[model samples]
Structure formats: structure tokens, C-alpha cells
Target: MKKQNIYILAIESSCDDTSAAVMCNDTTLSNVVATQKIHEEYGGVVPELASRAHQQNIVPVIHQALTKAKIDKNQLSAIAFTRGPGLMGSLLVGTSFAKSLALGLGIPLIEVNHMQAHILAHFIREEGFDRPDFPFLALTISGGHTQIVLVRNYFDMEILGETLDDAVGEAFDKTAKIIGLPYPGGPLVDKLALKGNPQAYPFPKPKVKGLNFSFSGLKTSILYFIQRETAANPNFIEQNREDICASIQYTIVEILMDKLKKAVKQTGIKRVAIGGGVSANSGIRIALKNTESQLGWTTYIPKFEYCTDNAAMIGIVGYLKFREGKFTDQSVTAKARYIIP
Candidate 1:
């Protein structure tokens, strides 16, 4: 049974985002996310630097979450943290902190999978939203991951398919760079693509043979095309900005939504949801809404708050685990490749 007044202090440092959240029962009391801006200079996240930033940001982030939630440290029933499927060093900081906090707070410690937490974000309460039932299908996309998942329960998760080469967010980032967008340019690409014609340049679609995906060809195609086009016109991208961005964004969105459609058909599952950072893309959301209507299925997308990395999602999953008497020991270790379906 679900517990009452079960306040949880959750920590998330899976990647470039350092976050903390407080959960009271099933509701998120407060969520604080600190994103690393240093990656902007390097054009992508650097593991070592990300870890360092986590070390610096975690303490303050947690303090802020608790402060905003109006919950005292002694009020927490348990401590929850993302334990795996992220950078090793970054995960370590959150793990070690959670372990220490649980020990100090004298409560149970619940370890969470970053990917699974993305799925469970649906459980975080919002006034007008409803939580998903069991056997739900999730399309989780991020800079590090692109996967279709099946959630049978709080603990039972399986991965249906994933990218064989690059993740969907990676494709977006790479494509954005090719188009001269700033670092973490995936969102920008989507925005610019809206102003441009989607058919300006046809990008190659990955014929990945199976449920697995490959975006290497698509990235290479863009790179080569850009190189050749710029060689002739130097200002080719500048001149046809909207078209290039639109075409690439269109192709990537199609690739993702197509695979998602197939996953639905093959599994005979009507309920569909999308999560992770890229789930915030306007293009993906619009496509999912349209597809859901055409396919006659219920579609779930977390509000932007839960879409990005946040400890509230972790805390929500931890709440479920806590109810099931799930707890982690001191020997619990961080895993860098946590997968779920």
C-alpha cells in the first residue's frame, strides 16, 4: 500500500544536471535542478568536469530543495538517489551523498535507475494529470539514451529497443553543431526547423534492419552535405538556414516517431508516453499527440518540469520502492548503464 506523509529527500547527479527534490507522499514538494553551463564551451559534456561540478552543486541543490519544500532534514522518511545509468563519477557523488544522508537521517536508502525514474515521472502529481497504469510503454530519449521501454510495475522494467550507434539527443546535438547552432543546440534546431521547409534537404533515414537504431549514417550525411555545400557557397547554411534545420529536425523526429509507432504495433500496447530531456522538444510532443489521436491511444508526456533531470522523479520512484519494502544497503554501487523497457 502507498504510504502517507512519506517525505523523501531525493538527489540526482546523473549527468550535467545536478538536482534535488523533496516528495511528500506522492506529490513533489520542491524540485531544484542546477545545470552545468561549462559544457557550452566544449560543445558537449566533459565527464570529469561534470563530476567536479556535481560535487560543488549537490550540497547547495539539496539544501535548496529542502528549503523550498518546507521540510526539515528530520522530516524525511528515507533518502533516494539515482544509482545507475549515468556517468560513473557523477553517479558516485549522488550515491555516496545519499548513503551518507540516509545513515545520518537514520532512514532507509532507496537506489533508483535514472532511466526508470524518467518513466516514473508520470507518477508525480500535478492537478490535472493522471498516473499511468501497469504495462505502460515509454519512449525515453536523452542525450545519452534513446529507448522504448515497458513498465510492468515499479521494479519490473524491460528495454524493447535502443539506438545501435548514437542516441537521439546526440543526433540532435551533432546536427545542431553542423548547422552552427550553439552547444546543446538540439532545441535550437527544433526551433529553427519550424521556420524552414522540412523538405529543403532530404536526410537519409536509418534502415536499421531491426528494432535497433543507427544515427551515424544520418549524422555523416549531414556532415558531408554541409562540407560540400559550404565548399561551393561558403554561406550555404547561412542562406538556407531554415530549410537545413527544418529538414534535419524533420528527419530525426520522423525516425524517432516511426520506431515508436512500430513499438506500439508490435507490442499491441495502446498507451504511449515519452520522457527524458529530448521529450521537451516541441516537435516530438506535437508528433506524439498527432500519432496518439490517429492510433487511438492515450499518450503521456511529463510537464517540462519533470521532462528534464530532477530528483522529484527519483523521489516518486523511491516512494513506490519504499512502499514495497525495497531498500538498498551500504554495498550498493552506481551503475553507468541502467536500462529499462
Candidate 2:
């Protein structure tokens, strides 16, 4: 007779999204994501506000994940949660919930790296194609991180390069705000970039020494440029919103692609992938697709749903870790920073 399949329930509330999923090995039966609209009122994610929202939303979110997957709590082999590189309070809610859930179910607990989970998310939905092979280049871009990572194995990863200043998402959000978009405006910026000219305003890419990036300067530059342009011609942005979005998006994408191209060259890996929220951007998608022909590399971009923070990702990561017997003790705790001790 076949063995009883092991299941893992995963939760992610590292930031604004309260997500959960149930995965049996690599096959995700259900992936549930709950986004916080409360944050929309603020110009950005207010840390404390995010935590409260997570607390309110986590229980129902988790239950829905289990129900959607048709997997009962007792059937779960282990529980996983995003434990760090996120807001402390935000991480705490998920961590505490996971710990309590695991304790209640008498199952093992596995703590997942929020960033690493984002990278591992590729394995969740399987993307309906040949999955990315090992020793490939993965760019994890989002609100707090912009990194080029080398994934050699399930848990083996090295940071080839990362942002030195503001993250790509921050750049997008700030740029969007300057252009009169609402908070969390990255998506809006992408939407507006379509009708605009990519060559409208040429923003100079910062001369960062290596693969490390610097988008903070770019954000400030855009602000000043907008201010100056508005002073000279009040209708400059009003008449050319699309152009502004296009130009700004182009500059940011160029910075990211430049480092990615270098990583491909240095690592000598032809397979490249992009993950994280910004990976959902149409511009980034087109840019990465173009790299396939331009740089002679096989490219990967997980399906749009898998790109953002979600439980299926954590479950995928959990699937890998579970096989290795990588269980975290009851004493496991959430971290706010990168280093684990």
C-alpha cells in the first residue's frame, strides 16, 4: 500500500498580504492570499498598522486555505511561516499563529525565510513549463529587496548582488507618488507606462561600482525633475503622465537588467528567473523576455500569482525542507533581520 501523503500548511504575512496554502509535497492544492486594503489609506505600509491587520485577517485566511485544499489540520505533517526580513510586528503575528497552530496540531514547525520563500515560490504552481534548473540566476525584486541570487539547491543560495540603497519597489512606489499616484503605487506606475514613450526623459543610471544597485538617487532625481518640470510648465506631467511612467520604469528596469546580465556572465548560467512582486510588472516581464534573445539565455518568470507573497510559496519551501528533515524546534523564533542565529 502507498504511504499516507504528508501535508504542510504554510502562512505568510511578512508585509501587507495575509496568505496561506496547503501543499502535499510540491503539489499545492490551494493557495489563498488576502491583501490589506487598510494600508491603502496610508502613503505606505505603516508597520504597526500592518501588524494589526495581519492579526485580524490571519485566522480566517488560514482556515480558508485548509478548506480550499480539503486538508484537515490533523492531516498536516508540519506548519511553515515566513519568519523574517519583514516588519517585526508583522512577522510576529504569522510566527505566533504558526507556532500556536503547530502546537495545537502536535506537528513539527518549519520557519521559512521570507525572501527565500519568494524565490522558492517558483516551484509551487509549476508555471506550466519546464521548471528552472538548479545553478540558475534568480532576481528577487520587491519593496524591501532587490537581489540577484544564485540558487544551487533547495536551501543552497548565495547573494550575487543586491541593492545598495532604495529597493526597486521603493523606487517604483516613490516615483509613482511623485507622479501623483496613491500609496503602493508601483502597479499604477506600470499601468500608466503603457501609453508613454520609453525615451521621454532620460534618467541617468547611477554609477554603482558593481552588481550592487542604488535607486535612492534615482527617486530623488525624479522628484526634483518633476518639480522643475512642473515649475516651468504646469502641464508637463499632466500632459505627459504616460511618458513619465515609461521613462522611470525604463530606468529602473535597465538598472535591474544590467546587474542581471552581469550575473549571467559572471555565473556563466544561461537560465535566469525573476521573482517577487515587481516580477509581475509588465515592463520587467518584457525586459526579461527580451534578455532571452539578446543575451542568449533561457529565461523564467513564474506565473503572476506566484510572483507575489503567498502561502503556496512557503509550502513549496516547506516541501523541500521537510524532505531534508529540516524541522525547527519549539524554541524557534521570528527574526527581523537577515542573519539567523
Candidate 3:
């Protein structure tokens, strides 16, 4: 018998970006993301504003995705959405829409964990991207999370270590703000760091024990350092913007690599993969690449589009769950703090 094609519509509104994607099995046919520029002025995402924007963008975004995929809603086999580990209001928006859409289309509803979607994003079919085998280590670094996860199967994952306070992406943004960068400054820091010297300003790494991570202290130290320097020369940030960004990126990348090395040593796993927004950082990418040559570790990094919050990641997870007949009923609701089970 010939295999049947599965079409999945995925929704993601865990934060400021509202996105939708249409996936044919593991391959993404269309992925549409609507980023909220409103949060740029606030120097961070505002929950209320984010949720409201989702309400406005969800329908149009989903429509665009289906249109781009050249598929009709009636062809969808399941509706998948981010269920939690994010802003409650944002989660609710995606959850309610997904439920209603699934009901209307008489299709199954699949709930995807936002963080897990980041990891499973590696599974999304694409040219020039190789999927990691089971029993590999996954480093998930995003604005809201920093975790080292052990992946044994599609649904089987264990978090080996995580952040105690601020996530690594948060650390990057906080440091950028200390130096008078704009909101959503993480990418800007990465951009500027590329042109600067990583060793120009040595920042202290946090002294966290075990495989866990901490960035709160590092962010505070950066703030104080900038303050002291600016007190003497008000143009310090302007004069040393590139160098400061490079140093900060270097320190953050070092922290992540240190824990990843420890995880590799403890678990004896050499296949490493990275996901989430911070994984897009060039410094971290370079460090991971260096490991492939220096440490004999094979690293997996997703495309840039898959790095940030996107529904294509959710769609890939939905496709996986659909294959196993794992579906949720109408009683399912959004969870703000849903963890991997």
C-alpha cells in the first residue's frame, strides 16, 4: 500500500512573534512569522501587547501559511500549537485558535511544548541540514530558556542542566541594554561582535556548579562595568561598542561551551545539537563548529529561520505526534509552564 500524505497546520504565539506554518509530514511547505515591533520601544516584550497582537495576526498568518503551501484547510490532518513554557496570554491565544480550528475542520489537535519544538526543529526536512540521531545532546538557548537536554527518542528527552536565574539569551540582551543598545538587542550584539575583538574586555563567567548555568551575576557585572566606565568617559560605549559586544559574546559562548563539554564527558555522547534563538549567535556557532574539529564532536545546528520562535518547529513536532496517533481532546488547554515529560 502506498503511504498517505499528512498535512499539519502549526501555530506559535509563545512570545512577541505570531507565526503559522503548514507542514507536509516532516517537510515545511510554508512558514509565516509576524514579529511584533511594538515591543522594540519597551526594550522587551510586554505580555499584554504580545497577546493582543497574536489575536490580530493569528488568522491572517495561518491563512498566509496555508495559501503559501497551496493547501486547503480541509486537507489538514491535524492542528498543532505551542501549549506552554511561555507567556500565559500568548499561549492562550494560540491554544484557543488551534482548538477552534481543529474543531471546525474535524481534525485532531496536537499540543507542542515550545522548548521541545526548538529541539525537534532539527527534524524538519531541509536541504543541507542533517538530522541528529537519537541519544544526542541538545543545547536549547533562547530568550526565556537555557537548557542542556538528553534526547533518546522523538518524545523521550531529559533535561541534564538548565539556568538557575536568567537564560543565556536574556544575559545577552541585558548586557546590550547596559551598553545602551536597543530592545531585542541580542542579534545586534552578535552583529557588532563579529567586527570586534573577543579578548578586548574580559568579563567574568559565573561560578555555577554541576551542569546547570547562571547568567544573573554576569549581567549585573556588565552593568556595573559599563556604569563605571561611562562615569569617567560618557562616550565609552560609543568608543568601544564593537569590542564590548565581542567580549560579552565570547564570555557567554564560553559559559555555554563549558557546560556542553561537561555534559559530553558525563554522558559520553559526542553528537551535539543546538536550537532556539540564541543558537543563531555567530560566536556560539563558531564555538560549536570548533568543537567538531578540536573535540571530535559532531554538532547539529538548524537554519537561521528555525532558530527563533517559529511555527515550522511546531509543525515538525505535530507531524511526529500525528504519526503515533497522539492527539488531544477539547478538554486540553494552554499551559504557561509546561515542561517536557
- Which has the greatest TM-score? 3
Best by lDDT: 3
lDDT measured at residue 254 in model 1 versus the true structure, 0 to 100: 93
Instruction: Give the per-residue lDDT digits (tens) of candidate 3, residues 1-341.
Output: 99999999999999999999999999999999999999989999999999999999999999999999999999999999999989999999999999999999899999999999999999999999999999999999999999999999999999999999999989999889888899889999999999999999898998999999999999989899999999999999999999999999999999999999999999999999999999989899999999899999999999999999999999999999999998999999889988987
Q: How well does candidate 2 score on lDDT at residue 20? A: 91
Candidate 1 wrongly placed segments (more than 4 Å): 1-3
Shift of residue 142 alpha carbon in model 1, Å: 0.4
Preferred candidate (TM-score higher): 1 or 3: 3
lDDT of each: 0.90, 0.88, 0.95
Summarize candidate 1's per-residue lDDT along 155-246 as a digit string, tens digits. Answer: 88888888998999999999889878999999889888789899989988989865677898999999999999999999998899889988
Estimate TM-scores for all models. 0.97, 0.97, 0.99
Cα-based lDDT at residue 303, candidate 2: 73
TM-score of 1: 0.97
Candidate 2 residue pairs that clash: none
Q: Count the clashes in each prediction.
A: 4, 0, 0
**TM accuracy, model 3:** 0.99
Q: Report each candidate's C-alpha RMSD, comma-separated, in the order given.
A: 1.6, 1.3, 0.8
Worst 10 residues of 1 by lDDT: 332-341
